[model samples]
Target chain A: MNIHAISAIYRFEMNRMWRTMGQSIVSPVISTSLYFIVFGAAIGQQMGAIDGVSYGAFLVPGLVMLSLLTQSVSNAAFGIYFPKFTGTIYEILSAPVSAFEIVLGYVGAAATKSLILGIIIMLTATLFVDLKIAHPFWMLFFLVLTAMTFSLLGFIIGIWADGFDQLQIVPLLIITPLTFLGGSFYSIKMLPEFWQTVTLANPVLYLVSGFRWSFYEISDVSPQISIAMILVFLGICTGIVYWIFKTGYRIKS
Target chain B: MTDNADILIDIKNITKKYDNGFTALDDVNLQIKKGEIIALLGPNGAGKTTLISTVCGIITPTSGTISVGGLDTIKDYRDTRKMIGLVPQELTTDAFETVFDTVSFTRGLFGKPRNPAVIEKILKDLSLWDKKDNKLRELSGGMKRRVLIAKALSHEPDILFLDEPTAGVDVELRKDMWNVMRKLSQTGVTIILTTHYIEEAEEMADRIGVISKGRILLVEQTSELMRKLGHKEMLIEISEPLSALPASLSDFDLTLSDDRKLITYSYNASHEHPGITRLLKALIDADIRTTDISTKQSSLEDIFVNLVRDAA
Candidate 1:
């Protein structure tokens, strides 16, 4: 199993995170705090409640998911990509560790970092709004699952990207915009009937809806469908990662 | 061929062809004995690094097989890789990592348990213990090269492959590295190195293998190769100048200097009888007075150039 090898890589990556704590931990925390101040304190007072939940509390799950998704992808992608750029990947490649262990180490570390950030953001939210959790177990479940799934996606992007610009393409252009439109600031039900139908097609909507349902028990879609969608996405990312290792994609040749 | 037990690495008919149809290695075959130091001498783009990379399992061979310690390199790579420690040609390192941490990390990567004692010994051997706490970027190029060596030796592998380990280092560091390699060899670690420095091969390798154009021309004991392919020249200074060579010395392969006071005779050193005595007698019979005589043998550099030139 090469457990030692996995832990070595894991510790190395975690150490890098600690070394860059300002960018890794503090930046996301500050950004989430600003979201609470601007959106929850400033804007929520001017808006009415939806589905019997306060507007400020309704934004909590969506905002946390927003940061979780972006952080997970960027953390994992940059972790693998920097090694390739610096030519240090040869050490890992020539070592006795297998592909699975390499992925486990890299993705596991990335998910852990995102999970920590997500929890911190949740704690920061308590300072701005009155938060509630109808299903605390499911809320934690959704957080861990979402972090892992997006981290795997980030790992794939890291292997696929050839340049630093490409590393930011997915997180900045795709994920951030999708999160804003995926019911982070408002409920999709508040939209007109036609727009509500279009919002359902956005994959981020499923993640935010499923995560929010665990908090307020009010969702745009059924809770079962959200779980199914997340599991399916996780499976797809796993399959792609397996194929990449098998084919020796950008990481190998 | 020796017994299988004595053969540590057996490479047979190995070829590596890149995707662009360039053949980096062509039907290469070699057998390295345990604890012997062999040098692969070649110029740039001669597949020296590719050969080392393939044996280290960094690059997959397009065809053929390699077995280390009787275990197939492809099928049993984990076991085989555990036995090899490679010091690569490039100076790739994490600038942010401290010397001690990077070396220890590599040991763990090879599945070795944490042994600060072993890491400390290697660092001290390479003269890197003083810089152990410094970030890699803070060290000089020579010191970074030493750190690379320390990392390679951290796992205490049975075989070590040094690919141009002294490429751009100063002469002092080069000599220091040679001494370290000698000590490792004394410890029964089989060492294989590829180098552009002919003197390095001549000074360190027990056997020298001349490779050119994706093929191995020959591999022979250093002393034996010198004797077999090396030539010798004898210079004879005459007591007086002459207009041309005397007909009596026409039977010998000789060339006279422009001043006509000196003559040179070239002969194969491998011959049992080089005709030196006969040539002296013939010179006496021809009534030519000799002032002084001296002989010079060819160096490994000369033989290497000729071999590579002929192969080309």
Candidate 2:
């Protein structure tokens, strides 16, 4: 609960993040731009506009979500996992640092990285296609909420992981695949009824739908439902994360 | 020691058992008087690390209790942790952090206000000031070990636990670490360490406790333990080769050494045994002759091994 400890850790972690500005900040920008080139410019010509938005414009929210989720996961994952890998966890664990301080420092840095990248991708999306913002406030809202949620998710993943291999398993294999299937690039309504129903099961669908609704003023799912789903998801993830910290699960023993 | 009422730690019958039912520690009881260094020594998997972890409140015990400074380790972790600094057996510091920032961050973790002078003194004592701006990965392993020490001491805890502080350390750095421990102890900081190397324990501990097979076999003053139970060895240089132990020399507990050119006898120094004269005469009667004899006194290792084996 001490703000000083948490701020100290947060500051140290921020310095560490800026040290890898190329990987943390620039790489996501480049990746989003490439999506515009290959998927937006090239593929949009054939696919035309799906639902009510251009193919290029349609992919923006998904790309933003993709970056936010992965960056949040990776930033938090590498942030925590490296100490354990390089044997520096002993320093952090043995100090007077509370579990809350450790979590705040790491998760706060991750949330910061996600927010910055989300904005960068948003600005980058505008250059490739005529991007619009129907609700800039909601867009910022979902962006910050989703970023914090996934940052907490990444915190859980980091503690659960013991080695580098463990750190990559959930993000690379699970999160990436879910994003692809969650209607990031294509609308579920375009699919057969059965596939559309299955796509509803993807938790990522709400994140992308909520974000897209903010920009286009229209989405396949209701904006209210999308917002609610994200909040619920955040609840589940926050519960898990704080519970892990309070009990001193993997971090302590 | 401050009146026993002010005992800094009270560890009562703590036991640790893993998932597979193997016990790492069992029925261990210890009280650490304020301002004392207690060394826990044992062979590998002898529960030394387990004991320290339990007291530090990092790992929960399967049974019993540990109270540090006055707070229970599990129930009152926040207050309890404030008074303890544990340098783990692992070198787990941030690889990309500068030495100054790492130690300073450690102080901040204890809710201490930013103090550059305190951080400077800690780094200076650890010889880390010169490398204050170097990333940890850029430093030598010895320097990294010093960082771990500095980070531990940065919080200025009343109690510090060093687990194998010199396990892979260089001799020079080992001596320096010893000096640091002495300085901290002089300031009335309680130090407890678990070490695989007995010599380090012999050099530093006021009292030594040997842990083996999930139990503390003996806890005694380092010197007193040796005086009471340590054994000695004497090597006899024989003029003639001996193929086997003599029939009448069974009382000597002897072994052939140097390809049978010498006979070595081990005996408890505290107990009455067959005199060296009787041993030499028995060797002569068996047509065994020795040119000279050399002797070696017992060390802490000998006493440690004997106690562990006896309990096992």
lDDT for every model? 0.91, 0.83
lDDT tens readout by residue for model 2, B111-187: 67789999899888777899999988898877887887787788788899998989888899899889989988998
| Chain A vs native chain A, TM-score per candidate | 0.98, 0.95
What TM-score goes with each of the models? 0.91, 0.85
- Model 1 agreement with the true structure over B110-154: per-residue lDDT tens digits: 989889999999998788888899999999888888888788888
- Please provide, for model 1 over A55-157, each residue's C-alpha lDDT reduced to its tens digit, 9 standing for 90 to 100: 8899999999999999999999999999999888888888898989999999999999999999999999999888889999989989999999999999999
Native contacts, share recovered per candidate: 0.75, 0.64
> Model 2 clash pairs?
A87-B91, A87-B92, A88-B92, A88-B93
Q: Tell me the spans in candidate 2 whose CA falls farther than 4 Å from its real position.
A: A45-52, A95-98, A242-252, B226-299
Residue B272 local lDDT, model 1: 88
Docking class of 2: acceptable
Task: In model 2, state the lDDT of residue B183.
Answer: 89
